[model samples]
Target: MKPIYSRIVATGGYLPERILSNRDLEQMVETSDAWIFARTGIRSRHIAAPGEKTVDMAEAAARQALADAGLNAADLDLIIVATTTPDQIFPSTACLLQARLGNRGAPAFDIQAVCTGFIYALATADRFIRSGGARHALVVGVESMSHIVDWTDRGTCILFGDGAGAVVLSAGDQPGIISTHIHADGAYADLLQVPGGETRIAMQGNAVFRVAVRTLGEIVQETLAANALTPAEIDWLVPHQANIRIIEATADKLGLPMERVVTTVEHHGNTSAASVPLALDEAARRGCFQPRQRLLLEAFGGGFTWGSALLRWG
Candidate 1:
């Protein structure tokens, strides 16, 4: 018997309509657009409206992905969501999404790895498809970061946004996902986390930056080595839309030019788990990927969590 691999059939993303610009933040806090832009390369990000929720964004993205793949909700063998801010505590966001899409009993659940979440979920879907546990899966990364951001805390507030991104995958003879690597260290969680009693994000920016640069660089090498490939072989770097500096360091490690990297931080900020998928969907919609081209996806987030996925475009 031949091995089965999971291939990405389609992708989708959704961002709230309300635009929150750095200038607006300046008014809300004591920060200027130039200062924020120089530090984070973020000009603006979308904020969900009062009535909007994480599941709503997830549904929109999931529906778009299903439509793009020409698949119905019933076709999915599994449903997985990677989200930090779910609509409810009891029901997993995946269940809520499955209900919205009218998909019944497909073993829906959620994964919480912060920014590395989508990568983890994608890897899980890949493994399930390979093991013959499922033929098709829907993986979604959605976050309502705006809901938890402390408007007064410019340090963390300017670094996050709310959005969702999704992908549809199917089992195939050839590999769509070449490899996936995920890791975490809870010891560094305090460096970047929303404290137990607080809803707002708190972070030691400098500390997090140092660790991110090192870990991300190490993973780039790990991914390439595992696949017996080199930095120059990667066609694109679809990274978590976090800080510009971290993205740059990863790009440098891959030796890929800026144009070859898919970056949405300037417009999307850090949508946590939604970052990579959102960037991927944006570039895919723009016809940026070509068949057989190699693409590298990576993310580093709170929990000191980080991961990478290598894939071929088809």
Candidate 2:
């Protein structure tokens, strides 16, 4: 008998219909389009409309992923949603998504690692499959960051958008999820966070940028070393879309050129936990990835949490 491995079968993503451009921010706050593009490489981002909840986006993405995999909600043995801005406090977003999917029995829950949430949730779901506890799993990363942004604060307001991304994983007997690495430092939490009980997002931009670049570079190396793989072996880099500079820095550390990275920051802004999966789905849909290709996914987010995952595309 071969060891069970978790492999991504399909991917999907959804961004709200409303497009909020930097010029729109100029009307709402005191920021210029040129300034925003120069700093974050974000020209526009999708904004969830009023009454559009995080679970709503998650459900939509999940349904698409399920369809793409030629499976249904009933086939899933587990559902894990990675989110920071859920629809409610009591019911986890995963639970809501499960109900929407008409899935009643399998375990469901949520994980909050900010922008690193997707990577963490993917790692968790991989373990369940490998442990024989789950055969099929749904992993989603969704965010309504626009709901938490302080419209009055130009710095933070210009950095976030709303969207969701999802993937279906199933047990297999091949190389799929090779390795996942996650790390966090609570001491740097305040560098980028929304205080408890507060709706507004805050961040020490310069401080977070310095830490993100250094830590992200280090973790990519750690993941590569652990897997006994080198940068040249990686076919695609689906990185967290927080900042172009940070993404470029990580690619540089991996000795990968910008063309090898899947980037969407210019249009999606930073969708927190949704960034990684969103980029992945987009790249996969564009026919950019091939079966058995080596892929590296990584993210650094508030917690100050950070992680990396190495996998073979299937």
**lDDT (0 to 1) per candidate:** 0.94, 0.94
The digit string of per-residue lDDT tens for model 1 on 32-131 reads 9999999999999999999899999999999999999999999999999999899889599999999999998799999999999999999999999999
Pull out the clashing pairs in model 2: none
TM-score of each: 0.99, 0.99
Model 1 global lDDT (CA atoms, 0 to 1):
0.94
In candidate 1, list every pair of residues with a backbone clash: none
Q: Tens-digit lDDT track for model 2 on 196-302?
A: 88999889999999999999999888988898888899999999999999999999999998999999999999999999999999999999999999999999999
**TM-score between model 2 and native:** 0.99
